[model samples]
Target: MAEDFTPPISQMQSTTLTDDSIQFENFSRRVLIKNIVGRPDGGVGLAGKKVTVGGWVKTGREQGKGTFAFLEVNDGSCPANLQVLVDASVSPLGDLVPTGTCVLVEGELKKPPTGTKQNVELRVCKVLEVGPVDPVKYPLPKTKLTLEFLRDVVHLRPRTNTISAVARIRNALAYATHTFFQKNGFLYVQTPIITTSDCEGAGEMFQVTTLCTDAEKVERELKQNPPPTEAEIEAAKLLVKDKGGMVADLKSAKASKEELDASLSELKNAKENLSRLEERSKLKCGIPQKDGKIDYTQDFFARQAFLTVSGQLQVETFACALSSVYTFGPTFRAEHSHTSRHLAEFWMVEPEIAFANLEDDMNCAEAYVKFLCQWLLDNCLDDMEFMVKNFDKTAIDRLKLVSSSPFERISYTEAVKLLQNVTEKKFENNVEWGIDLASEHERYLTEVIFKKPVIVYNYPKKIKAFYMKVNDDEKTVAAMDVLVPKVGELIGGSQREERYDVIVKRIQEMELPLEPYEWYLDLRRYGTVKHSGFGLGFERMVLFATGIDNIRDVIPFPRYPGRADL
Candidate 1:
């Protein structure tokens, strides 16, 4: 039989508990004193209202005559803080109740001393210690805690004033983003985490595979794919050279079609010989071959699978159908980079708009960013104040700038010209009209040149994504990157190519297999409209909003190179 539980009459009594109930709830043995702000109603302020509250002890001042412990208690409901004053007679707590010890304080709410900014302080009738706190064990000491040190102790960092404040501000910014998108009539779409296509096409991906990897099975896969033919081998070598510094060899290379075919035939024979050798080695190791090379195809998919670097391409497809859609999820990148800003896994918010050009994308990105800043400032006053006092003094100023002013916009050509003339810092890669802007160059442009967020557009075609629409001059692609002062390359986007033939040509020229991407190509084959979207690094945005410098601190469980701790 299940037991029926009931609360005691004493526990059910309405004692008019206020926010200060946290001061002495469980720590004190007998009566718990709570200091409250005011009446829960819209009646008179703390002066005329009879109320009881509790809070945590922020600081305790014990002069010989009387012990006045300033209790900073919160009901965990609102941002408001309630202070409680404990007389020596009532507070037998002495040194037992340290900072962070939850306590309940009960008293009539009364105004503090003239110099005290607080409106009311409870003259405690009782002080109860709900829990004991050890100051030495807590990371949050009387002195301010640095964000760098807090990175090593992420679990407990949120309990501190600074981190708690950041959480509050981040929550506000997130709320603002959702509200903004909702108001604009955009549908939120959840994109898949594990994807087959390498969206960025950079080929720098963290592979995902669950296929059998026994010695025999691995050899079988090699036999099916076979090594490159002599001609194919030469082509692969050339491709490698082109990516590296082998300009002379590439310039001198020349081969007829027949000669290339002959070389490929010879290479195929050589690959067959190598496969036989591998088979023999596997047999020597007493492993059985699953199937003959001629009988088996490649193991599974057309190509290997990997974590998606971005969700832009997938969302762009939905945008064509839904007209306006956005994907907000985790994106992976295998850069092997160890930086404060880069994360192996980070959340990316990407929104695609059909029939929208690069200009429309810029408008959306700016509006979205500004909307978040304004929302945080309005809803998270306490958190903002905490950050201003402890972390970055310019935090409020930056937020205000984003909310009030228009973002700076400049073409890539003009930006390159400006960089060349500017003497602040010299870049290794010459700032030419055609080259890609490195992260350093972007930071200089936004933090130094513009002194605000800047959108650089129309990058050289050779450097941008394959689907970007070509400019009238045919020299550049209709692409844009929204660069922030501290966070470079905050958003990367472009106006996609709408013409079917042009996209097909571009795909063929790249030499990537087309059979797998038939569906993607069909978008162009059928009705296609001008579309554009940008990927915002969610962690970087959180870093900016909270005035925290490290990307690792923003994520709850950070996954970086060779590090995953649960």
Candidate 2:
């Protein structure tokens, strides 16, 4: 059942690629450093082959009495850096000896000296380009930097060993995600970034509107031409009175036609000036509103809109028609949380199945997750090594364990009983039947109790979303969460409630407006087939795979409450 993209990945599982069968060539004419250094032989076998390479220098030092320069260049194609030897005649040693210098050179791949860590070295024949660095102004040095410092200089952190590997791993995972779903006969669909409906029914959504910009526009205009003061308005009014008197005098004296026209023009001009000043003075800086409420009619969308918290609802629409569909896109939440687990904006992978139940949903989730773990092991061991050396030592082993082990399935009630029965360790949150499971509870089950991934299903309806299918007991919903070590709940899913009357009742019981969801109800009203779907926080997958601690580090740009810097 494997697809075309499967063989290369599968082949990579056993041995390192030494052939052109798996290439990471970029569109540029220059060859990727990965294609050279990532080989089992580390380009030593390709000696005497002339090639062009482009990258930023991680460290450069002049040697041989300034006759040549040795540069450790990394193009971020891989975690490894290629050792480049540039002659003073081919390129200025000074220009190439800086930490952040950009170097593009045509060189012959040669074997390095015996006993060196590197297997291959580049002998440059000619310098193609050079972007010199001001070493004094450069922020990153050869010294070791803390992760907190890296976060502050996120713009340049990619050049570091850690972040670049993270970037590559992230790229591979994203590619693997699309490949897995597409190979499984699922269509990739795009859901909206701006939505009118809150799929989670939680009001923690970032409101998207133009009202703030509109208010800024007014304030900007006033700043450029400040509003007329009360004294200025009075002066304008006095001018208007004087002009009226002059016009009246001209009419009474039967002045010449030219004088009468001139007087009338002056009167009109004065009146307009007075009116303008009065209006300007009355202008108060504030958001325009009506009836003491935000006039959303003046907004960009002509109504209240928000950055989508999840694409599940929209993807479900596609699943109804396409049978199998998935959406991977950015989702936002306005939760004012400052924990390592929360991000204001993050990505989500939501898949909806037209004819699947809770069991099928669990099967799909398990398969997809296992595939991701195996994918990393097969393709990203090089980058994972970097993660291990720097962040977490158990990163690779965890991946292997999850990829090979079958996730244990248990009922939510059973999991609660297990937590309540724990005698060795105490939980901060009390174990209860109706309460939603917290991260500590989840981690305890996966890490302490089972020591493997676990699926807890049949959550209490009151603690779950309204769209979850009600169970036979009428108290629980067909909801499931896949929890794992390091990270707690990695995926949340449920069998959707497809009955129109039941959904309407549920919506009413939750005190949500039915008008906004009329279209959703129509799906059931017309011809609803049983469906199920799940939402996987993309960052959580990256965190789990990389064993990175903070949710912010895995993503390229972390957006939290006070930090959205690029």
Candidate 3:
């Protein structure tokens, strides 16, 4: 049934090219390669029409005994290339045949010979522009290159088939996410990328500071007033002792009340001045320090801040007010993980639903993921076919399975038991009731035990975030993780703890500083209602749909442990 759901290429071609033909008559604009050759008819109906086209040459070769050249050009609007036949009389064949050459030409669309695979070809009439490329210098050649090799050439990787397909798939997924949330009446909220609170409370946030840029100013200040030596500190202490002695002497002399009070005031001022000098003497020639702690008061934000790990806390405020809201933006982590699934920076789609519980959260996450899977199948089949051919063979089947089947739901205890009972494969990590599920465990549950997506809910409170609702049994929290094959956990969500007292207790139990989360708890303080939300890693979704092994390849410019190449 999934294979039967093919995109109507002929209809798409007729509609797009027909409109382009009319536009050419009116405005005379250049046509996109997708509109020209992407249709099921292979652009047969538009023959004889002169049009302007521009793209980089993928491959070119001299033909007809070196009198002309045939060039395969692509503009990245589609995966397909347009065949252009350029005669020697129009332009030099030597410059046009090199791979990665950019060209713009006026050509007449003509039907190719009947036996060829392409239905139509472009016959160049005039050359307009040429941005030549040196075949020896171009990083991308016609030969296949591994994705790892492509990372070194991030800027040019999109020109490759794999990267281009990933880009289109990523774009389709993003569009599907917005469409799915908006259609379901969720308000799109833009949460701050730089936040004061670490949503995960893991203390693994990239500190955002201006200290590096303002280092010179700090150094100059310390140079101007250097820290005092031990001898100077002792002298200041002596001054404070002398001031105390003067105050005591005045009190013992039995002088007039006003005169004694004046002496006491002078002594107090002397002691205060000594204390201030002693404190200034501790200043170092680096980031401002107070009591051996990095003083964030002098930083840009006047307090400690970091790139947001998640937008759940910020979006929850909007959820409490608006009933349903979602924030889709880039988030950062300071993790040094070099695993295929970890990234220093990535985008997250977090949707907060007010008046919902764990069951509602699981249902919403499953439906949203299914919507994305079906969207790619419906609109991006061409790219999907390319992925299926070159990458994983089961990618399409997996998409169809996830899109059509209902996810299996079970408690965390049951999931642990299922893994415990399994004797077919030995898990790398030991199965336990309260320990966090490792990626090996999650994959085994999805790929081996279930053969489908599994939603494991009600995890132990000790292993989950503090905001998750604590069950009445006091052992497990209302949390859930949706694990799929290949990718471990696709979504993590829970019904938020609404009781202010319980949340305070949980915060203390987790040993987290409560000040940073005061605003988040304010949602519970004022007219709190039941709410739930989940965060879906956008790159992980792409990995699942495309069967891409490494998460970095799916994201355009991946930020990882030591790599942020453009």
RMSD of every candidate to native, in Å, equals 16.8, 6.3, 9.7
Model 1, 164-249: lDDT tens digits are 66666666766776788889978888887767776666777887653444446666766776644566555555554443333333
Estimate the overall C-alpha local distance difference test score of candidate 1: 0.70
lDDT string, candidate 3, 94-131, tens digits: 99999999999999999998899887899999999999
Model 2 TM-score on a 0 to 1 scale: 0.87
lDDT for position 212 in model 2: 90
Model with the higher TM-score, candidate 1 or 2:
2
Error of 1 at 98 (Å): 2.7
RMSD of candidate 1 to true structure, Å: 16.8
For this target, which candidate reaches the highest TM-score against the unseen true structure? 2
- Backbone clash numbers for all candidates listed: 31, 0, 0
In candidate 3, what residue range of length 10 has the lowest lDDT sum?
Answer: 19-28
Q: Give the range of the ten consecutive residues with the poorest summed lDDT in model 1.
A: 27-36
Winner of 1 and 3 under lDDT? 3
Clashing pairs in 2: none
> Which of the predicted structures, 1 or 2, would earn the higher lDDT when compared with the native?
2
Of the two candidates 1 and 3, the one with more favorable TM-score, higher being better, is 3
